[model samples]
Target: MIPLDRFSGHANLYAQYRIDYPPDLYNYLLSFVTERRAAWDCATGNGQVADVLANSFDQVDATDISETQLILAAKKPNIRYQLSQAEQTPFANQTFDLITVAQALHWFTIDAFHQEVRRVAKPGAILAEWGYGLVKLGSDLDAVLLDFYRNRVGPYWDPQRVHIDTSYANLPFPFADVQHNQFTIHRNWTLDRFLNYLRTWSAVRQYIHENEEDPVTDFGEQLKAHWGEGEREIRFPVFFRLGRVMDEPVQ
Candidate 1:
């Protein structure tokens, strides 16, 4: 299992290279919080989404289990960074207008996380969670990259530990209604940017360091040999699942 603690050291690269959600996703989130009130951004790594939340809510408190991530987020204005885990948030009961988890829900213990979310979110408040996956350029070269991830990266990561579907699917929040949306964003990148982004993934970082394989040296050579060195544009899809906390038990 990939320990969560390893991320503390990679905070800067993660902050710099991780993809940001598109503006439309943020707009969809805002629709649920018509009151323009407080929102909690659970596992708010480096404040990327929290920065956007600050635009929509009067008060946005961003929290993460990793103090290193929170420390990086501290530089953002109007975002209060707290060192708290998703399973045990320190916020008071029914205190938030909305609670959002982005890209980090997979790392949480679902039962405790759901209870904590329930404790802090106001009745009928919205609970939104999202996950994203990337697609490389659709070419023979891309196949090589995909195969590398599917065979090499996916197997090493603990399937049960990193899997996120159940956490979102079995939300304890009695949702009266649920909505799912998919958004596509195109990232145009130069060779350097593309490589930097790839290197930021924890799986890739772990594999390189643990195996003593020089990702920078080997992956670069392979990519260049296959695709040549230049600029490329790739489209990535972000999946969003939004549900309203149930106000009352069904009869």
Candidate 2:
């Protein structure tokens, strides 16, 4: 069994501060899915994408290995939240119209998860995965944020993080490729809200675990002092990959 890396502790911060993907992102993905019947969102992290899918699909199965994260997810009548891993799931063959992983695909065991994807997805079903990298604030605050992300807590990031940093271009996707337009997560937030989002970073959690120091404390101080107390719009360039499941499963 693959060991579970729990991010449940970060769930609250994640639900509160992390910007949800825009409607255009879903609209683009929905175009590829032939049917809006059933969809599976693996590693559904607080049901961010799953919640969005619920509006378009008749039924949405949202799965995550972290129970704590699920507890924080907003409940909806059409959404079912379950605890399951991405690489190995109890779902049956050809069970879904679309499959999505948002910001969490890098953590999956790619080969195993790809096999599962083939088993669960119907022929021509759409498979979409995406992640967002470095937020764009203004130049000054952006520089400080970069230092905190790269220099302060870089080592603590999971090796899988490189996939996101590089925009999942290197990811081994075992599916028929589908070209897609660019999507960005654009939103406005107060400085406090943005800092809260940073605290949800896994590397930030690791930095705290190893050093017993809250790196955000210093960074937050500097950010507050420099930017003053106000809100600003932030944009995170979202990197996404789209593809269609093959009709025949790989043996």
Candidate 3:
């Protein structure tokens, strides 16, 4: 498997600039979960998802491959942070009432991870995995952003990034009720603040490391040229899959 962690070097950037999911998404995920005694947040970067799960569950076990990222993760009394890969874990079988993967699902070897999910999750447990796509600046200023995403730093992005581009539509989810849903992340940010978020992208980090140039600073200039210095509400389109872990083995 390819090294799944690309954000280890910029763990601080991830903790500082990554956008949070919407409340509607949490409500939707929790609605299907009948028993919330214990939950697992796989690939729980920064422990943001686990932090939220801790609010509802008796215990939330969160795991990640990168210790640097986990070190900066959100901490709660009910949350346990551990170093582990997504495809395999140290948790006992039939451990979780709810299993979740936030934006980090694409990093896992899906087939192996799904098998592990089935092994650890209780029968009839709800497994929800979701991720948001490229940020949508207003139509007027988006060109500048797209130029960077598709041109400047595009080649630096990993091949796995295609899954995110299509919003995971083509990714395999061999489970029932794999219902499709869309959620919007609404955030208001000044141009410079938005640039910080862009810096968190794995591709941007790669671009800087490879080329030794700061594209975000240049992109900021392009944006400021278009956007008059003020806060604007930006939206990220979220794609999600919610399924019930079945008793029958996946063929």
Candidate 4:
């Protein structure tokens, strides 16, 4: 993957604006494990997944490349936040019972990360990676957002974004695979809140820096027009791929 510093530019925005993982996501992962010894949240931007893992696991190690983002991550007694890359980490081999990557796997060097996961993950360790794509808010609002996403700042998105666009169906997952039904996170938010979330997009930030323009600002009028000046239920479709780490080496 092409390396980029996507989140540091707006670490505070990232912390304040990003949505939460569905509460039941942790339960789905836990179902595969016999023991809740420890879990690693890789590419753990703001410890979103790590925080969830902490509630169940005895210990949670969350790693990210950005110290700025790590600083904003939620603090918990059972969670340890580290400035580390997804492809390389300081943890010892075969140490984790579960490893989850939430919404940030697309930024990783997938093959190398798979190797790192194999090294740190215990035999039969559950490895789950999930991401949410464009939020659905009915056709009227959806069309406006998709126009901005696909045509406005589409060029700025990383190549890995396609994996998310397709719900990670073709992501190179090197493990003994498992299946889970589709998951979606639903929230009710005002148009202002939704716009704040949109402003947190890496592409949106890049567009602002490159062109000195905030497209979302111009788009807001259209959004508010369609949204009808009230709270609306937004659905964030989550795509997940779960697998069990094999006893043998990745090679």
Question: Judged by TM-score relative to the true structure, which candidate is superior, 3 or 4?
Answer: 3
Q: Local distance difference test, per candidate?
A: 0.74, 0.84, 0.89, 0.85
Q: Is candidate 1 or candidate 3 better by lDDT?
A: 3
Best by TM-score: 3
Ranking, lDDT, top scorer first: 3, 4, 2, 1
In candidate 1 the C-alpha lDDT for residue 7 amounts to: 66
**What is the number of residue pairs that collide in model 3?**
0
Worst 10 residues of 4 by lDDT: 173-182
Per-residue C-alpha lDDT of model 4 across residues 1-251, encoded as one tens digit per residue: 43566998899988998999776776776888887899998888888778877888899999888899999999999999998888888999999999988898878778898888999999889889888989999866778778989999899777878988988777677678666556888999888888889898888888899999998888888777678778999999988878899975443
What lDDT tens digits, residue by residue, belong to model 2 across residues 88-138?
Answer: 788889999999998888888888898899899888888898888989987
The TM-score measured for candidate 1 stands at 0.88
lDDT of 1 at 111: 64
- Tens-digit lDDT string for candidate 3 (1-251): 65478888999989999998889999989999999899999989898999999999999999999999999999999999999988879999999999999888777788899989989999999889899998898899777678889999999898889999888877778776666789999999988889999999999998899889988998888778667778998999999889989886544
Instruction: Score every model by TM-score.
Output: 0.88, 0.94, 0.97, 0.95
How much is the lDDT of residue 123 in candidate 2?
81
Q: Sorted on TM-score, highest at the top, how do the candidates line up?
A: 3, 4, 2, 1
In angstroms, give how far residue 129 of model 2 lies from its true place: 0.5
Give the residue spans of candidate 1 off by over 4 A.
Answer: 1-3, 160-174, 247-251
RMSD of each: 2.9, 1.8, 1.2, 1.7
After superposition, the stretches of candidate 2 with alpha carbons farther than 4 Å from their true spots are 248-251
